[model samples]
Target: MTFYTYGYLTTHHNTWQYARIGLLIALLVVFIGLFVHYLRNRWNVKYKDLSIITGVLLLLVLGLQINSLVSLQSATKQSGEISATVQQAAKHLKVSPSSLSINSTSVSDNLLIKSSQGYYRLDYNTDGSAFILEKVTLENPKIKLVKE
Candidate 1:
């Protein structure tokens, strides 16, 4: 998870945003109730001490909630960027590109490349150009493209 964060942004594993919120609210309610009970039952305990504890707990909870929200938002934004880049690559590869004979690369087994249109391998070396295509063999064996 940390490695992925360092490179590609992934969505938070917790898809249950509502559940997380509910759990946090429940914990806050329980903590407050317990603190109140402790204060009411313990005459020796100072109210000032309880107030301090409550303030600290509230701060901690708020910090946690904010962090979770920020992390979730960041993951979403990064994932969107990655997806957009992949789509752009696909679009460019589908555009007119020079094709050659079948290659030995693993990506060649499932796709066929043509100068104008064909299934394109995602791992082609495009040299940062608009797109690149490599020859691939399909199961049907009927795939054919004329070299331009």
Candidate 2:
């Protein structure tokens, strides 16, 4: 599914996220096992110390990954709101959202909407405090407005 935010559009990959987290967890478990083995064998103090440090670093990275996942979920919610608003606007212009070509940039809040019926744009202010309809250009024949 395509996710539209203030500045850009993103594609969701549900399976990839889960796979990445699972891989990290597996690596952490393997590291822990190795750490225990080194300590039990008393092979080298340096090896044991290195393993402990590596384990701590992995834990820190795992925490960061979880935090990022939470942030992404919130962003997805905001994207849904933006998408709904766009669909409503398209209905007002008598066109399906699917029929329009949407263009968004990562550096700007403006979204360009274009279709055979006309061209339009909307600007979503920072923090989503406001949504401004920047421009609307209807075709010369002017299609019949359809309310959905």
Candidate 3:
């Protein structure tokens, strides 16, 4: 809810918006309630083997989900930590927010912002610091900007 609210307050750039994770959490809560009831002998179970298989599968799915979620959250947090850096870079470059574009570098702790001048790679290691690098983008490689 807070994430959604924050997105609403800021920009809705994330298309997924993590709705799948929310749905998975709701399903997990319901499953846990039913499983608890079954364990307490309050729920009727006609297919014990099927239930066991389903529980195991759910656990596997949950484990995979946890792993992915942790990685994604860390990446998101790392990028998020440099939001102010991006804004300041934009102001320094005299670029408007609409024209400024920000991206993250997985290879390093850097937040990259592309502008007409070049790329501004912000490095905030608990210190006020940033740097820029120039790159000549060719229009012939439009696909490169989109995807590989």
Ranking, lDDT, top scorer first: 2, 3, 1
Per-residue lDDT over 1-148 for candidate 3, one digit per residue giving the tens place of the 0 to 100 score: 0011112213433444366566567666766766776777744684444456556767776776788777777766655544455556667777764455555423245445556576555555454454554344434322213111
lDDT of each: 0.47, 0.61, 0.52
Task: Tell me, by lDDT, which candidate is best.
Answer: 2
Best-matching candidate per TM-score: 2
| Candidate 2 residue runs with Cα over 4 Å from true position | 1-10, 14-23, 42-47, 105-110, 123-148
Going through the candidates in the order shown, the clash numbers are 0, 0, 0
Q: Give a tens-digit lDDT track for model 1, residues 2-58.
A: 011212222235556666677678767766776787677777465546656766776
TM-score, candidate 3, is 0.53
Which pairs of residues have clashing backbones in candidate 2?
none
Estimate the overall C-alpha local distance difference test score of candidate 3.
Answer: 0.52
Can you give the lDDT of residue 16 in candidate 2? 60
RMSD of 1: 11.6
Off by over 4 Å in 3: 1-46, 102-113, 117-128, 132-148
Worst lDDT run of 10 residues, candidate 2, spans 1-10
Q: After superposition on all CA atoms, what RMSD does each candidate show versus the true structure?
A: 11.6, 7.7, 7.5
lDDT of 3 at 146: 17
